[model samples]
Target: MNTLNEINWFPGHMKKALDQIKERLKTCDGVIEIGDSRAPISSFPTYLDKLVADKAKFYIFSKADLADRNALEKHLDKYTALGINTLALNLTDRRAMQTLINRLSLVRTRQEERFLKLGFPAPSKRFLVLGIPNVGKSTLINSLAKKKKAAVENKPGKTRSESLIKVSDKVFIIDTPGILEPNYEDKNIVIKLAILGSIRNDILPLIPLTDYLLEYLLKHYPQRIYERYHVSLDGNCEEIYLRIAKERNFVSKNQSDSERARSTLLTEFRNGLLGGISLDE
Candidate 1:
């Protein structure tokens, strides 16, 4: 198994985002930590456990539609058992957005009651939605606002600044730009996997990462491999990628099959064509 140590990716803006988050933490009531459902462990920032220790916190497994449903359910069960208020939400779903709002309301009410018990004046409930780039934070906000207020894109680093939006009379959301870890050697691999759209099959140019994903998928979810692309597993990762290339009719100018078969496979995999596959599962 190739550990994710080879990939190196980190932007300078992440440090700025972290500083801004720290500056604004005092004004906020709690944090809504958003994580990619496909790779929750990788998507989460380890520093958050201490960063938001003084403030209330909630975890939202975002992009639930693309992740393995069973895996997500298991995660939810495990996290909930540990007393973490976790919610599995598909950001594109309107009803799921409503449910999330209601859950946030309940959490706020409980916190308000606790503060009241302590003889502290009840503060207005403010939540900051924090996540890495391209984890669907803006889309989630758009769903909640019921309008196209936040800029959303499939690419990473789209939201470069923080923007506060009022969702309701009692609930307000502070939308922060996606923050990536700085020089943290451990998470570099996971960041590259996410940028390559290893979670689903919408983006392309999937060469090295696609081969990695196929091998990983074949070893774990063989049934999904057979079901999605109708390819049998008889050989190694290279052979499987070639078989997919041949099946998809992606040929090069020299009458040779293009390497694009791997690219196409990756794109489809990221778009949920390979079924709701979760990398962490």
Candidate 2:
């Protein structure tokens, strides 16, 4: 797998966002941390978790519509066993918003109890919404708010400021800019993030990222590619992609367009055309 050394992922804005989030956490009563369901464990930043660990936290696996159900449960169970309120939900699911609200009500109730015991007036339940880029933070906010209250985009790093949104009468959400960890020593983790589109599209090359995704599916979810692309997984990744290109007539004069083929593969995976695949392994 490519180590993704060429990606200029951490911009000055993200560094500044981290500092701003640290300061903003001071006013929040809880945290609603989102992560991609395809690579839930990897996309959940350990550093950010450490920062919000003391707060009443709810861990959400967004884009559950694009992840393997079995693999998703495996990941969710890991967090649940740690006693963290964890849920796997696709933003489009109508029930997701209510389920989330139910879980958050617990956080609010706990906050109320805390304020009572501490002899402080209990204000509205305030939660800081945070996660890596492209993790559906904005979309989730819009869903919770029951309107287009937050600017939502499919790309990474779209939302850039901290804003307070009133989702319900008794609950408020602090929306923060998505930020990656300052250091990513694990290349595999970065690769998974890229594969899941959590990393910015321009930050990493699609060829290498798709190649890693190729090898991963070949190893763990070969049936997915076979069913979706009708391509055999009997050879190296290059050979497999070429086979797909050949089968789909994605070629020029009998030669596969490497760029086009890789892009197609990545787009298929990202769009869930390859079925519910997971990079949790």
Candidate 3:
């Protein structure tokens, strides 16, 4: 994981995209910042405030369906209390999203009207939906349009370009490619989120991350593991992993323990099979 200051993961294309965002910021009225709900603070780009300096901003905690409801509520409250207009959303909830879209439109309209009275042409009320890779920006676009207007996949870096999608007559979304801060140094937060699938799991080492997640689940979401895999959590993390492996019949014919059990458990937990769990809380 890379920290914002020590980010070494920014590719050439991402640098170009960052340049484009800076250029396009002049034409846009505000920004819609999207982040993973489960790890809101960690997943949010630390440099976003500086990048969008003084711009009207709204925060969307995406994948709210997979987050603890209480945690989500508290996150919303915390952000809102800071005077940031915030929303927690499950991409599948169209009715609730309609309301969100409406609110965004109203905000844009208000901004546009204020600009109009100054005798300048109405600024295009553009919203840049920005987040780290795989934070579900594309899925949010699809959900808002009620169709597949943008490509969406479980993999990271799926949407690698900026796109404009109109959700209503007044609201337009500028979808940017996901950006990763270079070489994040916050190993613990990174590992936790990777296990949650909030970060790209493919790029990370599964065994160590899975081990960390196993320990975490044992302490925080013990019932979730027991309920999902029918494993007793009365033992150590390695024992728990072995129990899950035995239950799922994940074994090597060589009579040795297979690491597949750990991988499977990690994947299931990431995909929310263990329920809507939040790693941070």
Candidate 4:
């Protein structure tokens, strides 16, 4: 097995965004940490804990619709046990979004109490939203604000700066660009984030990633591969890819197009065609 020695993806825009976030944290009432529910642990911006430890913190694990129900429930349970305010659900669900909005009432009340004690008028609640790359921070903000206030993209690093968008008359959210640690301490995290589309796919070798996904699915979700492609899960990753290539007619000349097979496998997983998958568990 090949291990990634290092993955340093911190760009110029990310540094600038971090600086702005630190400066603006003083004015914000709370912090909301967002991450992909499919790989919540890996996709999380764990580095932000130190920065937001002093403020009211909430965890919103997005894309819960695509995460394995059992695994997601377990993850949520662990967070709940820790006494951390955490929510795991689809970002588009209106009811879930309402629950999120309602939960923020406590944070807002606390901010107001602080302001009153300081002899200042209570200001609109400001929440600093932070997440790793491609974790749906903008989409959550858009859903909360009930409008297209932030740029929603499927790729990473789309939002380069923080934008204050009013979700309601008394609530404002500062959507910051997806920020990643300069380097991940665990290399497995890099692979997991890459598979979850939270990191750039081009940064790693495609074959290794595809193999990792294939092995994981075979072990934890063999039925998905069998049902989706009718391929036997008894073989190795290469054999499985070849079988899928033949099944999908991904052939080039006399040989199976392994590249296309790998790409398709990854795409299927990302789009949740294979089923609800949880890479974190």
Candidate 5:
């Protein structure tokens, strides 16, 4: 992998998005911070610490279907201890929609006092969906609305601007572009984000990222590699990737197609074919 400082993770639009968020935040009553359940901590932006300090923040661990129950429970316990309300959700599940509505309803009640103290009558509750790319910020909006109000795609940074959607008469949502800081302070967090598909695959080299994923999977989920491709948890990451490549016949024309194998491994891992693994433990 290249040095973390060398890679330009943030683009111009993301910076503009941050400014837009701060400007738009003034009208919002609370924030629904979406994070990948597979990597809750890393996916949650640190810049939001001060940004959401005064706002009612509800943390949602999105895509729980791809995470381990044990790891998810552990993260839930940690956040609960901190007094932050959190919900683990699979956006495809209809029940999760109702669960979110009920939770946000409670959040509105909790924040009403804060609003009243500010010399204002409690008005409609507005929530901005904030998270890194491809963490389902838009998907949550679409799910809640039960219609395609916001564009839904399986790519990061698809939401380039904020669009309002009315989920209920009193509840509103703003879907914004995934906000990553202009710079990455820690490379491991970047790798974690890349591994979880929050960042686009093209931003980084495939082999290095795949190598990191290999190490990460072996550490956090040893059995998954064997289960999916019959590749045992053995040898270094490159050797393991090579082994899988050879096993899957990724080689042809007298040369091994390591790139194709890497893509396959990453896609399967992202698609949850490697079992329910969590990188945020």
Candidate 6:
């Protein structure tokens, strides 16, 4: 993998998005911060610490279906213990989605009470849906609205602007473009995001990322890899890649197609084919 100096993870549009978020946040009642459940801590933007400082905050660990249950529970416990309102949600599940809407409804009620106490008329509760790129921010917005209010895609930077989405008469959310911290310097976090498909694939080489994934699986999820590809996890990542290549018949010009094998491995893991794996652990 290249050094941080060699990569431009924070682009121009992201800076614009951050400015837009700051401008819009003045009117928002609370923040709905979403992050990937598989990597709750790393996926949550560090920049948001100041952005959401005094606001009523609700944290959503999205894509819970793709995360290991034990790891997810640990994260949920940590946040809940901190007195932060949090939920682990599989966005596609209607029951789970309804639960989120219900929680937001409670937020709205509390917001109304606070406003009324201040002698102001109860106003609509506005929330800013914030997170790093492709952590299902738009998908969560669509689910809350009970329709396709925001564009949904598997890749990063799909939503280039912020838009107001009405979930109920009294509850509104702003869907902003996913933005990473401008000075984010964690290479491990970058690798995790790349493996989870939150970062653009071309920004970093896939081989090192795959090696990291293989090492994690070998330590914590060896059974999953063996079950999926019938390849033994008895060797280094290069050897494992070769074994997977030979097993899957990923060959080109009488050589193992390591690139193809790496890409496939990443796709399968991202799509939850290997199992419910969590990178944060």
Whole-model lDDT values for every prediction: 0.73, 0.82, 0.75, 0.84, 0.83, 0.86
- Per lDDT, what order, best first? 6, 4, 5, 2, 3, 1
Clashes (backbone N, CA, C under 3 Å), per candidate, total: 9, 0, 9, 0, 0, 0
What CA RMSD would candidate 6 show?
1.8
Q: Candidate 5 on 1-281: residue-level lDDT in tens?
A: 45667787798888899999999888897899988889888888767879888888899998999988898899899999998889999987766798788778777544688677898877678998899999998889989989887887888889887788888767888999997867666688898898887778788778778888887778877777788888766778777777788888888787667778889988998899887888866
Which residue segments of model 1 deviate by more than 4 Å?
Answer: 1-7, 109-115, 118-122, 183-192, 195-206, 255-258
Better model by lDDT: candidate 3 vs candidate 5: 5
Give the range of the ten consecutive residues with the poorest summed lDDT in model 3: 1-10
Model 1's number of clashes is: 9
Candidate with maximal lDDT: 6
Task: Provide the TM-score for each candidate, comma-separated.
Answer: 0.87, 0.92, 0.88, 0.92, 0.93, 0.94
Residue 115's C-alpha lDDT in candidate 6?
88
Residue 187 shift from truth in candidate 6, angstroms? 1.6
Q: Candidate 1, residues 111-186: lDDT per residue as tens digits?
A: 6878889999775688988887788888888999898878888777777776777777678888888876654555
Evaluated with TM-score, which candidate comes out highest? 6
Model 3 agreement with the true structure over 1-281: per-residue lDDT tens digits: 23323423466777877787788777777888887887787788776679887677888888887888887787788887897788888876777788788778767445687887998876657788888878888888888878888888887668777778888876788877787665566667667656656556555666777778888777887888778888678767677777777887777885425378888887777677787767676
Candidate number with the higher lDDT (5 or 6): 6
Per-candidate RMSD, Å: 3.3, 2.1, 3.1, 2.1, 2.2, 1.8
| Candidate 2 lDDT tens digits, 66-154 | 99999899888888899888888998665678878877776754668878799997768889998998898888888887778778777
Q: Which stretches of candidate 4 lie over 4 Å from their true place?
A: 1-3, 108-110, 115-123
| Candidate 2: pairs in clash | none
Weakest 10 consecutive residues of candidate 5 by summed lDDT: 102-111
lDDT of each residue in 1-281, candidate 4, tens digit only? 34476445676788888898899898887888997899878888888888887787888999998999899889889899998889887887766788888777656446688888999987778888989888888888888878788888888888876688877677778888888887777777888888888778777889998998998988898899899998777767888899889999999998998789999999989998999999976
